[model samples]
Target: MESRQRALVLHRLPYRETSLLLDLFTEQQGRIRLVALGARRRRSTLQGCLQVFTPLQIQWRGTGGTLQTLRQAEALSLSLPLTGRALYSALYINELLCRLLVPDVSYEALFGQYLQTLCQLAASDGQYEPILRCFEFALLQALGYGVDFQRCAATGTLVQDQVHYRYQAEYGFVTAAVASQDSFSGQQLRALAAGQLSDAATLRAAKIFSRLAFKPYLGARPLKSRELFY
Candidate 1:
């Protein structure tokens, strides 16, 4: 059966002499790869619609395998005008989705969240941190690696506002005696739990927490987008 959905091009590369291979995140089909025949040719209309961060209505059909042939693609709206940090951050989000999300599965909510993240990034200047952090946390939760910030993993005790804690992957947060570079304050945890990153400290903590949380799944290979940040 043919599947049609709204998608965003996550990554694309030249295929053969004239085609393009695309990794796409679709609202109905999670992440999938497609071959856009003749997309690289000068007159191919797919060239314009098949771009990173462009919202597209795409159509495809295939049997049981990772690769499919893209039948059609059309831009749903003007591509979000991202530049500098926002552009890099958008790339980071695309890379994360391509890396961590399972192919051929449905991540309906996460797909919407991803689009919203891009919109938020495009609308702001340098305030991409909180937006990225929120999307990262959401992505983690959607991938079944969500860590609870409201309680201690060690004792299941409620996280206190005055204490500190450290994230232990797969295991949730554990209480820390004092704050350190590796530890997060209870207030930060609470703010994160509430999805309220109101201060610099909480934003900083969220970044560290997300990096630590993603380390295991992302393996040792550093994300290429991370390099763009520095």
Candidate 2:
């Protein structure tokens, strides 16, 4: 049977001689690996359309195996013109998705959110923190590891506006005996919960929280896209 869906090339690599292997995020199939036969050939039309961040309508066919063969791919639109920090941010999002998403499972809402994030990145003037934080939080929720900002997961106590807490990845936020430099205030957590990056402090807190939330799933390897920042 053949399957067709809307997709974005999350990553691609050279395959053998004139072929390419693609990691695609599809609306209907989530993350899938496809082998694009002869895509790297000089005369192949697919060489131009098989690009990262480009919207595509793809068709593939396979059985129960993990890999599929690409039957067709057509560009739905022009590739997004993301550059500078926005470009790096987009790469980070792609690499993060490739690392965390389970294969073959449908993430329809997340696919929409990913497209929206790309559009936001294309339109922004380099203030990417809030955009990234929101996407990261949404991805966590989609993965069933979302953090509860309104209450301590350990104690079930309401998060007070004045109290400070420290994040424990396995257990969520807990009351801290001392307000260390790394601690997050209840106000900041609440602001994040409300989708408000109202101040520099709150923005900083969101970045820290996202890092902590993703640490366990991401394991020990550093994300290649992150190095582009420095």
Candidate 3:
């Protein structure tokens, strides 16, 4: 049977001197690998459509294994004009999905969310850290690894604005008597929980909290795209 769906180009690599191997994220089928034969030819029609962050309508039929051969790819939307920092952040989004998401499962909602994240990146300047933070938190939540910033895990009490707390990697936030580098104020945590990252303090703490929560799932290998930030 043939399958056709809207897809986002995640990653692409040269194949066999002429073809291109693509990692694509589909709306209904999740991540799939497909090879576009002769895609490197000077007159290839797939050239413009097969790019990272470009929305495409892809058609293919599966072989026996995990890979497939691309029959056709059509552009569904215009290219997102992301450059500089925003481009790197967009790539980071791709890296996260490629690393953490389970293959062959339908991540329909996450697919939409991913596209929205890219749009947000394209529209913002250098101040999109909060947008990325929110997307990261949302992605973690979608994957069932989300950390609760609303309540203290140890005491089960509502987080208060005046208190200081520390985020344990395995558990949720706990009130900290002695603040450390990783310790976050209760107000900041609450603001993060509310997705309010306009303030510098909350934005910084949100990044720290998100990075800590994501560290385990992403494994020890650092994301290569993060180097583009520096």
Better of 2 and 3 by lDDT: 2
**lDDT winner between candidates 1 and 3:** 1
Which candidate order results from sorting by lDDT in descending order? 2, 1, 3
Pull out the clashing pairs in model 1.
none
Residue 135 deviation, candidate 3, in Å?
0.9
Best by lDDT: 2
The list of candidate 3 runs beyond 4 A from truth reads 63-65
lDDT of 2 at 192: 87
**Model 1 clashes, total count:** 0
Per-residue lDDT for 156-200 in model 3, tens only? Answer: 999988888988777889999987778888888888888998988
Q: Model 3 has how many clashing residue pairs?
A: 0
lDDT of 1 by residue, 79-127 (tens): 9999999999999999999899998889999999999999999999578
Candidates ranked, most accurate by TM-score first? 2, 1, 3
Question: Which should have the higher TM-score, number 1 or number 2?
Answer: 2
Pairwise lDDT winner, candidates 1 and 2 = 2
RMSD of each: 1.1, 0.9, 1.6
CA-lDDT, candidates in order: 0.91, 0.93, 0.88
Displacement of the residue 71 alpha carbon in candidate 3, Å: 1.7
lDDT of 2 by residue, 1-230 (tens): 78999999999999999999999999978899999999999999999999999999999998535578999999999999999999999999999999999998889999999999999999998789889989999999989889889898778988999999999996789998989877899999899889999689999999999998899999999999999999
Which residue pairs come into collision in candidate 2? none
Candidate 2 C-alpha error for residue 44, in Å: 0.6
Using TM-score as the measure, name the better of candidate 1 and candidate 3.
Answer: 1
